[model samples]
Target: MTGEPGGAATDAMQFWDERYVSRRTEHGRIWSGDVNSTVEQQLKGLPPGSALELGSGEGADALWLAAQGWNVTALDISSVALAVGAAEATKEGLSDRIEWVQTDLATWRPSAQYDLVMSAFLHSPVEFPREAVLRRAVSAVAPGGSLLIVGHGGFPPMSEHAHGTDFPSFPSPDDVLASLHLPSGWAVETNALIERTAKWRDEQDVVLVDTVLRVRRDE
Candidate 1:
């Protein structure tokens, strides 16, 4: 992945790198070791094929996709995070099933289309053109393929982590859908906010809202 030399772009990269490094040092893993619930629920019963995952932190979703028979290309901006995920994949005997790529999505271009493109919780604190990236992701979808994007709708009422950060505004389902500007033959399979219970600090179950958008390119 490549981008402009300076300004917010550089800051974004450094911010993510530091964040991942800290996570690796403190927690050993940043995200849950399981595939994202939105991904699992959306992909269930669908035929597996080529998949590209953006911001594939810790490779949980990618590993799960590979285990289900989809060849996966997992891309992330953080090498520290990728290394941790790579090690986990190797331990699970899934090393050959995934290609771990270190890339900045701000400028990374897809060389080929995929049957599925997924981005879960791809929020960033730095300045980034997320909509442009999402447009590129949609362009990389082959006909009859699908794109799934899930993001935090808002912080849970009981949250502590997101209390003091300048978290970017979470996009609504309509906001994400409108950004795609999909042409004819494309279908909006899912566009809504869904709530799920999550374990927070192993103390209590917290209800979190997810803004989910799934679109399919018609055959």
Candidate 2:
């Protein structure tokens, strides 16, 4: 559920919980149980370490990372989503490798630093303090660690989104970099726009532009 739309202007927990719970009765899962393409492309083959994911929908990325020997903290607003991830983790015997945390990112702060901090497609249809939350994650990155943020640059073809007031016009990679306000010790690693095919409404395939940014703090 990296980029899925679940609006919650007042109660994010209830809205997202219902979104996952109701949908699970129809579709087994909202998203494919696989690592995000951006995460796989950017982090594959790197040494396993502590990782934190801000919007860990059903824990696909978390499971994938744990399978690769990385300890992961998967956080989400909905307890239902976390339960799904935890169930899958136990079934796969990866429960010990991952910790599921249910909390709203707006008020929750990381108590410990991670070697990798991820905020993959942390978007919502409702108004959110996204930049402020991202700023909170900056100080949680350990020395020599990296922060990776991926976002939707545009909607898939033939999809409902029109980049209008209705849909969220996701930020660009440059906007993310500017918002971070990292100090001099940080170095930009990869900041580029990538094109990839994505599923629209779980059926149609369309190409989409992805905003990708990865920055590392000096050791």
Candidate 3:
């Protein structure tokens, strides 16, 4: 992310909050309200349990988990964005199932563990410790629980609507796994690129590739 007059945390909050406010006014939302296809696919058949979502923008996945009987902690940096998710959960009578927390993931620490600790698209254009934060989240997963990380491998060809293009490079599934430094007791479950349908300007469907990694600790 481009540097602003304020520090990184302040800059992130201001940038994301303002971005959400503008997008909400112009488009009613910044993202599709549906759960990400990869998240929906990977979580199926797993028994519901306590889950923590890093960068839970607008709460689609969090809301879906709650509807499936999992108590969720949805964390985001922008209060404006979290407000939209909270309102939606309330309207759906699922408010009690989710806890929306507005905190910068870069500096925040988890005091309690959860059965599932997952992060989808946790990248930021602005400077933050991406790998370090993800490594930190590993400590929050309970025994036999899973740590799932999903990221955009890249955008469609010649598409100007590309996202997160500011990064130096997109890490592969193996690159992500090596960065985690997983112990022998843990098992790598899923590490591959998954293709799913995504919308371009809400007018047409496009194929999006995701780098997905799922690792579980021994029970």
Q: Best candidate per lDDT, number?
A: 3
Where does candidate 1 clash, by residue pair?
none
Q: What would the per-residue lDDT of candidate 1 be over residues 17-87, giving only the tens digit for each residue?
A: 78876765345876668887877888988899999999998889999999998999999887767888899
Compared with the true structure, the alpha-carbon lDDT of candidate 1 equals 0.85
TM-scores vs. true structure, each candidate? 0.90, 0.91, 0.92
For model 3, what is the alpha-carbon lDDT of residue 188?
87
Which portions of model 1 miss their true places by more than 4 Å?
1-10, 25-27, 160-168
Model 2 spans > 4 angstroms off:
1-10, 25-27
| Candidate achieving higher lDDT, 1 or 3 | 3
Q: After superposition, how far is residue 166 of candidate 3 from its true place, in Å?
A: 6.6
RMSD of 1: 2.6
